[model samples]
Target: MTFFAEIFEGLRISWAAIRANRMRSVLTTLGVIIGVLTVTMMATAINGLNSTFQTSISIMGADVVYVQRFGWFMDRNEWLRSRNRREITMEQVRGVERQLTTAQAISPVAMTRKDLVYQRRNGGAVQIIGTTEKQVETGGLNMSQGRFFAAAEVEGARPVCVIGDDVATRMFPNESPLGRRLQVGDRTLEVVGVVEKRGRFLGMFSLDEVVFLPVTFFFNAYEQRPDLRIDVKVGSLAGIEETREELIGIMRKLRKTPPGAPDDFAINQQEAFVQNFNKVGGTIAALGLFVTGLSLFVGGIGIMNIMFVSVSERTKEIGIRRAIGAKRRTILLQFLIESVLLCVMGGIIALLLSAPITLVVALFLPAALSPSIILIALGVSITTGVISGFVPAYRASQMSPVDALRTE
Candidate 1:
């Protein structure tokens, strides 16, 4: 017979054997079902988190660099040292901007959280960002209505503000927020523009619960020395690294760091944040896979044990087949096929069960079911079947026809 014909014959025989002991076959597959479900769910959740993180960081503008007082992902000692470092100020921001030839836009940002009231509708704990007119360029925000605060307004520290989409919807649901007065702290400001909707970051923090105003106005109203963050947008994507180097040199001069002295300020970019996030994500994936592997290992052992029992119970049948024209290879193929079929069946059922579970998880966290995950789950199941069935299949193939007939 041809190779394909042999495989078909083995499959037919295996299916008949499984059907003859339907309950046993079903029970044997339970282990694999549970294993695949655990693995698939874990993969789905990890993939979802990765997808959501990428989307969230994209909103921060890949080409923009933030000059801050403290670095992200610093060690305890480094954090303590950075905490005592001088705060980045607007004077330093201007010094860097003056020498930056490769930069497209530069904005100094300061932020505070306060309660905002507009006609009895109150929004508590709203982030109020104080920035210059260049903020729109540096931030990559698109206007939904009206216009961003003008250069004149920022220079004059005018009582004007641009609200985020969530602020607009919640605070001004009944009317267009444009040209409306909103009380921020003890001062009342006019709403100049509304930002387009940018969804939540990491499925937790609301990106839209924000208010943007002139940095001068913020300093005036709060009367406090707020730490400033300098945001610089590069003129071209290819020149980002060059601009970063240039900015570092300029900032070092502005901060009056001695030659060869370690720089106090941190130049943070979106890629740095992504690299840190990837490290975290990779650790989570590794830990999850380790736990899931134990479950799959247990399932594989169950399959191997069940396959050994199956070979013992069908010894007489094996002898009868050997007595006929059947070869040892054929007997081995039949048992192996049966074991693989059982695992594949279990994998299919797990996928069906995982779909709804993934959907429910998506409602609360980022959870995705991708095609690669399905393929991997099925492949793992098939591999487990082959490895677990090998010994049993070899034993069945090695049986002597005479000895098999003697067994009752």
Candidate 2:
């Protein structure tokens, strides 16, 4: 009960001191405010990256594996070897469909960039994807308008197209896009469906700036012998490794290479993207935390320096308190409380500033001032106060009452 009373009195005295030296306290708190901002922002960015990556990967279909001629990332020698291999053909895709047991859906995909025109408005360098109705499933598309182009449409080599939401809004802002004709280079096609809006990938590249059309239409219009990638969607995530192994054997046999030589085709899975993202994102987060931690360190040092000055100026007060029978621990608690108050004040101000800053940051990057960040920032501020004020508080407590009184 005595200890609790002492702590209450300590808070009272400390708060009074801070209020009395309002200007000094405010200036001292600036460092802590800056430190809190950096830490909060860094944590927010790291969190945003994780969520954004998951969202983006889902749009690309996490369950689907890509079988392509070239790997997504490879060494120079690997690239050359892959370049020398025959392109994965529509025929091979059919073979994979026929033989593969693990795959639930298979989509033969090819892409090219073309400028799209709706009346006078031209969309610059829009990506065009050529795939079948299976693309609706394998690509994780949700139809916001109309429906996926039917299998009969693909079979009949219809020049119908499915537009992304962004394109739909941009091209036909005033009216429905369904049944409207859009020009894809020299070719004219009718929009049969509009895919739901998927924002950007990593808040950078737009995912909704693409058009999907039949594979035959793509081949006849773009490349005669198009380089194709087969998207193989699996049933179970737990069996992904087995799926990859099954794909490798099927590809090796399909390619008809001997058992000793390396397989010509690259079978890419979501795990590759996941593993690489984790490695890179972890390094970036570590570096970000380290850099932000320095600001806190500097703020702590500034608080320590100011606390020493505060203790020097209050030596006579300490002397009087000791003469009145104040314990050393009481003196220690008082200054420590004052330091913590200053830091907590800074943390509150920092949080206030973070609201607008977070809004602005969200415009360019996906960021949020989550509840966890708020708690962490305040906890850091309190901890910094304790660590910074300890040495100065100990010095003040160890002062001789007689010696302190003699200075005045």
Candidate 3:
């Protein structure tokens, strides 16, 4: 109770001091405000981006791997070597299904961009994917309406199609998209199913801006010899490493590669993407740390300098208080509370400024002022205040009453 009372009294005196020197207090708080703002916006942007990236990649299926012509992140030398490798044909995809023991599902995938049409409406430049019914397993797909086309339909070169949320909404607003004949590129395809909304990819490209069709029909409509991507889903995530090795051996055998030569095919997976993203994230974290440290150092020095000035200006006041039998702890608490109040004010102002900026970022990502970051900002402000104010407060507390009184 005694400690609380002292703190309350200190706060009352601190508020009075601030009110008496309003302009000085405001200018002193400016440095803290800039520092807090830098700390907050950097944390919030990274948090939002991290969250968005994780959600986007969740649907990439950790248990799945892609056998593609090239790696996603490749150097010039690797790209040159992989460029002339033989394309993965659909027959190889079928052969893998027959021979592989670890794979749960295997799909031969191909893609192209085309304009979509339904009645008078046009959805410009949408991604169209060609794959087998096994894509439902290889890709993380949840059908919101109707059903995926039958295996027989896929083998028979049927013109049935599955549309994503964006396509279903834009092309058939007032009616069910099922059984609706939609024109993709120049060929007409009936919409047999609609995919559930799966948000954007990396908070940039819309995953919903895609349509899936049977590879047989796709080849008929688009290119006769389109490059293929073989998607393989293992029975479990633990089995993926062995599954990749099996795929390499199968491809090498099919191509009849000479002994001791490097494998020509690339087996890409979600982990490769995650590894690359981590490197980029590390760079961003380093940069943010550097800027935050510099700002806090400059800001802390300004607070310390201003606090020393405050102690010098009030030497006579300190002398009078000491002569009247005020304790050293009370004097120290008074200065410390004053320093803390200024920083709290700056933190509040930075939060107000950050709200609109966070909202603007939310337009492009899943960003908001999470509760954790708010606590962090306020906690940083309080810590900075204590460190910056300690020396000035201790000097004021240790002042010799006679010397302080004689000065002014």
TM-scores for all predictions: 0.94, 0.94, 0.94
Clashes of each: 0, 0, 0
Model 3, span 86-118: residue lDDT tens: 887777777787888889999889999999988
The lDDT per prediction is 0.89, 0.89, 0.87
Error of 1 at 45 (Å): 1.9
Clashing pairs for predicted structure model 2, backbone only? none
Model 3's number of clashes is 0
Model 2 worst lDDT window (10 residues): 234-243
- For model 2, what is the C-alpha lDDT against the true structure? 0.89
Model 1 segments beyond 4 Å from truth? 235-237, 405-408
Model 1 residue 332 lDDT? 90
- Tell how far residue 60 is off in model 2, in angstroms: 2.3
Which residue pairs in candidate 1 have backbone atoms (N, alpha carbon, C) closer than 3 angstroms, thus clashing? none
- Mind giving the per-residue lDDT tens digits that candidate 2 earns over 108-169? 99999999998898877789999999998788889999998888988887999999888998
